[model samples]
Target chain A: MEKSLVINPDKCTGCLQCEMACSYENEGVFNPAKSRIKVFTFHQEGRFVPYTCTQCSEAWCQQACPVDAISLNLVTGAKEVNESSCVGCKVCTISCPFGTINYNQSSGKVIKCDLCGGDPKCASACPTQAITYVDADQTGLDKMRQWATQTDNATSNTASNA
Target chain B: MHYIIIGAGPSGVIASENIRKLDQNAQITLIKGHKEPPYSRMAIPYFLEEKITEDGTHIRHKSNSFNEQGITLVNELVSEVKTKDNTLVLSDGSELVYDKLLVSTGAIATSPPIEGINSNHVYNCWTLEDARNIAKKAIPGSSLVLMGAGFIGCIILESLLKRGVNLTVVEMGDRMVPRMMDESAGGLLKSWCESKGVRILTSEQVISISEAKAKPLQVNLKNSDPLSADLVICATGVKSNTGFLESSDIKLDQGILVNEFLQTNIENVYASGDVAQGLDFSDQSWSIQAIQPTAVEHGRIAAINMVENNSCVHHGSINMNILDTMGLISTSFGQWMGVEGGEESVLLDEQNFRYLNLQFKGEHLVGISSLGHTQHIGVVRGLIRGKVKLGVWKERLMNDPTRLMEAYIANI
Candidate 1:
């Protein structure tokens, strides 16, 4: 079965290990600026949200790519940027609704998450288990299970009170 | 069913692909006028900058992509569209019949009418051939005078600089990118480019270009001294390619007119990309948005309507322009000029080359223009495109325009 990277923002500690791992895996650096996965800090609310390419089946970046540089990797189901073909026009960056794809000024090419060719470094590097790779068909399975267990406990508590 | 798509630009290619997806047995023919592989003209700047090779500009990297997809690639120009006959007369004296026809011939660069503008050493950076010619003549330390400071001009500004040319930009407007930027924002862009060693002459016009003994070409100005340069690159503007449809029944305006379904007056004829003037989302007006996103949207919608019989209606496209001049990033979205009687909130930091102007109509955010700030700015586009009601956040934004992210999350 195909696997997908699932993110649980509630479990995130905002240590940026995922960012470092992603940058090193893709760009060979520990710089968050170069990382494809970004953690946005909501300073006022004390919240951190990690965001990256969701690998949309109908990706705007893929469709709007002037040179057709973005293509789907069948094995990983990841939209990969062929750097050799990319002209670095930044059209993909602008076309992406989530702003996940960005221009690499140094290489003169656009960069995005490639799921590390099926073994995502961000998922592997998460210290808090906030990011995990699971079956693509069951991305919401864990959340559903958690809610189901809570409902069962509440129903049992009500029965005992009655 | 046979689908004939003229022009192998983004619109035609995407439409063909989408059609192939929807109809497995449909025969798709993509006619490209140029001899080169289907390539993007927008990638010409990158080609000129030596970031990628000429092959890198091909719309599809694989040589046999169209063939593999069962799409026939025709290398001939359409001379006329016979709407009555449901046929296209190509330049090579050949006629092709089609059940449905899509006109996506795109736009051509237009040079201002001036004497000797076509003289040697003057070129338009429009096509791959133009980029090749520019790359040869734009050697390091070469003197190049670029005319016009519009969107196209500013796009190639950095590429020209990176080539190490002693460059001078002459714009007829009072400041840079006047069509997309306001006076204050445009003025700020001018100063930023000037600081990067570009000689900018605003409110200046090139009267004529003549051959000179001292230089390759002499560019005469309307108000100032003539400038001598090794090359003169014109980036004035572009006009839609609708000459082929002059005699046809296809409606015409500044471009070929299409309705909400991207269909012309003719039932089987459709138009998309820069060639089709359709609906504008911000003001519900009809206009041409010569951008890639709009082209992609139009292609998909038109192709869907072609196969599914008016199954899709184009809601219209937002007017968005993003530019990176030198190292500064600037963007304008929707009705950035602001409607009359609309409220505006502006934040200008000339010292840091940062500026933000938000235009609000009553409780809704309608438009925005920003420079030098890139973090979470996509929310600004989301707000404008979503037409979110700002309510009390309008006053909060007026107090501090930097709170756009907060305003967007709260409202959207």
Candidate 2:
């Protein structure tokens, strides 16, 4: 029943509005440089992708944080970072495979997406539903349905063709 | 020793976070030159209208969370980088070693070359500090001379007019945003700004800026008349912040040259934000741009690539910018269609501020420019993504941007 942010690259306008929203929600400023969610742009291809920590069930950042600052929220399944306990060693940054954990040299700590403590404004602020907070377990439902419809599109061969 | 980010702007910040999720043990350090925490560079103007506070635009009010994640944050201007030795010399004569580096120094606003352009009242609205300095002098009834009539300049004019500043906009080009949008769009925007109590003068060439403090400062233009001003804001254009890279071997034309991975010629060194530029992933090897989204995406891709064990994913940035003038959404994506993509056609809705121009090399949607709010941008975006059959949606796209949703396909 856990909710997660869904990103539809097709809908992304490459505006970085979601990034600003993320930074504002967590950092109290509109700096996209501090946002947890990111949107990638492929200029020549005219494509944009919004990316962030998927908040995996088996979270690597939670396990790698030696100072015990990284923990998971039971209610929302978010891998939250405890700022007070962090040592700024950046061990969790390397242990996690996706590169979602990062260090802020100004405060000497790591930062990432916490899903805005559950509501995730990135989904709400998106003018286009490129980023949406959806059911974590059924995250693949959209992709599955698209593929399912394609299965119905391919034409069956007639017996005479053999 | 896992990642070394050169700039603390949006791209470096987001990329570092992305890398951390993949590898928690990696050490990530972001170096920023600005005195305050990273804030939205675009929202600096909104702050002028008191729409948001200094704290309101801050990108990271809380850096402790990163400290908990074991990331190091450095707040100093990087003077030099020894990629040969993998070290960075800081402003305070300190040095930090790195296994990898990502640069997102961002772009610098173009300063008009007019004599005494550096005078007290001359303004540039690129940074928070710049905006703050301009705000101090923008008192009610102040006569302001705005140089340039582009998007930022236009927004500044609109925002300041609301404060009752007697404003005048001067542009060297025939129209605003001439480099990006066509003359048609620029003319439309100029007329729109004029309707809001701002004087618009095109084809203006600046000769000098002198002291006229007793009244308003005189902006002597190459044209017959001079623009008078108590305050002057320049929004001519922006140049990539690659002057420092001149000392290094990194390639630079208009900006720092990088590849699809956002990596520079110097190994283990990557750049993004304003200072970095590279070939477009979808077009010619022309310089990409200094836009924010592209920069952040470049940082993420570069961070992933810098981590060798699990090769991080990276992508290139196509030039795209959307202008939100408070509520009026002006979207410009892909090529102008008329510029590089080939023959172009148009669907104009002057009454609705909606104009959809379709550029095609026959059947593909190579470029599109929607002048007004059209929800079907998603569909247009999909076609631009190189999905099949752009012609199928041209008639429909002309009708509505929302139809793009129905035009989308899993494969396309």
Candidate 3:
């Protein structure tokens, strides 16, 4: 089964380990600005949300690429940007509704999450288990189990009352 | 079903691939007016900048991507579309029939009527061939004069400057990017480019181009002294490539008229890309948004309707333009030009080269134009596109327009 990166924002602790790992793995640096995955800090809400490319099957960034520089990595299910082919017109950055894909000024190419070619560093670097590599078909399994356990306790409490 | 898609542009190529994905047995044929393999015109500037080769501009990295998808590629100019018979006449006197058709011929750059404008030294930088010729002439230390300072002109400005050419830009408008930017923003851009060593002539018209003995060409201006240059590039404007459909029954206004499904008046016929003027999101009016994102969306939506007949409806596209002039980045979204009675909040730091203008329609953010500010900027688009109601945040934003990301996070 194809694996995917599943993110649980509730488990996040505002630590930027994922961003550093992503940048170090992909760009050979520890700069958060150069990282493909970004952790947005909601100061007022005191919540940190880690966001990156969702790797949509019908990706807007892939379609918006004028030179077909963005292509699917069948093994990783990641939309990889071919640096040699990309003309860096910045159209993909605009087409992406989530705004995960961004242009790199140094290389004149757009950068996005490629799941580290199937060995994602961000998920492994996430200390809080907020980001995980799970089965593509079962990304919501953990959430479903949590809900099921809650409902089971509620049902047992009613039965005891009866 | 036999699907014929005219024009091998981004719209046509994407639609063909999508049609094949939806219906495996459908026969998809993509026709092209140019001899080159399916390539993107937007990448031509990079080609002129020597950043990418000709092969890098191909829409599909694999040359046989079309063939692999079982789509036929034809190089022929479409003469006419016979809607009644579901047939098309090619320029080579060949007639082809299709069960469904999509016209996405895109647009062609227009040149102003000036003497010697069609000369060998002058080019329009619109096609790969034009890029090839420009690459040869726009050499280091060469003198080049570029006409027009609109969106297209500004886009190629960096490329031309990168070639180490002594560049001069002439614009008829008082400021650069007149259509996209307000006077303040445009004027700031003009100063920015001027500071970067580009001789920009505003409120000037190119009277004519004449061959001179001292230089390869002499560019005469209506109000200023004539300038000599080795080459001249006209980035004036572009018009839809709808000439072939003049005799056909396909309706044409500013472009081919299509409904919400991107289908033409004739059943089973559709249009997309620069050739289609469908719907606008901001005003809910029909207009041609000749941008790449819209073209890609149109292609996918049009293909879906073609395969699954009226299964999808286009929600219209926003008018957006992002331009990188020299190192400065500027973006405009939705109705950048404020509507009547709409309030506007502007923050201009001319000395720092940072500018932001937000146009608000009541409590909703309708439009935005910004320069040098790029953090979480996508939220600006989301706020305008989602039509988020700002309520009290409107006053907060008016007082501090830089708090857009905060307003977007709270409201959207």
Write the residue-wise lDDT of candidate 3 on B1-412 in tens digits: 9999999989898888888878899999999988999999888878877888898888987878889999999999999888889999999999999999999999999999989999878999788998898889899999999999998889899999999999999999999998778888899999999999999999999999999998999999999999999999999999999999999888999999999999999998999999999788889899888998788778888888898887776777888877788878888888989898999999999998899999999999988898877655656656776677898889988998998866765553
Summarize candidate 1's per-residue lDDT along B39-148 as a digit string, tens digits: 99888877777777888788888889999999999999999999999999999999999999999999999999999998889999888888889999998988999999
Judged by whole-model lDDT over C-alpha atoms, candidate 2 comes out at: 0.65
Better of 2 and 3 by lDDT: 3
Tens digits of per-residue lDDT for model 2 on B51-79?
55776555444657567667677888888
Query: For each candidate, what TM-score against the reference?
Result: 0.91, 0.72, 0.92
* Runs of candidate 1 exceeding 4 Å displacement: A140-162, B375-377, B389-400, B403-412
Clashing residue pair totals per candidate (backbone < 3 A):
0, 63, 0
lDDT-best of 1 and 3: 3
* Candidate 2 C-alpha error for residue B382, in Å: 2.9
User: Every model's DockQ, to 2 decimals?
Assistant: 0.20, 0.04, 0.21
Instruction: Rate residue B282 of model 3 by lDDT.
Output: 87
Candidate 3 ranges with C-alpha deviation above 4 Å: A141-162, B390-396, B403-412
- lDDT by residue for model 1 over A53-136, one digit each (tens)? 777554667878888888888888889998888877676665554566887778867889999999999999999988888888
Best candidate (score: lDDT): 3
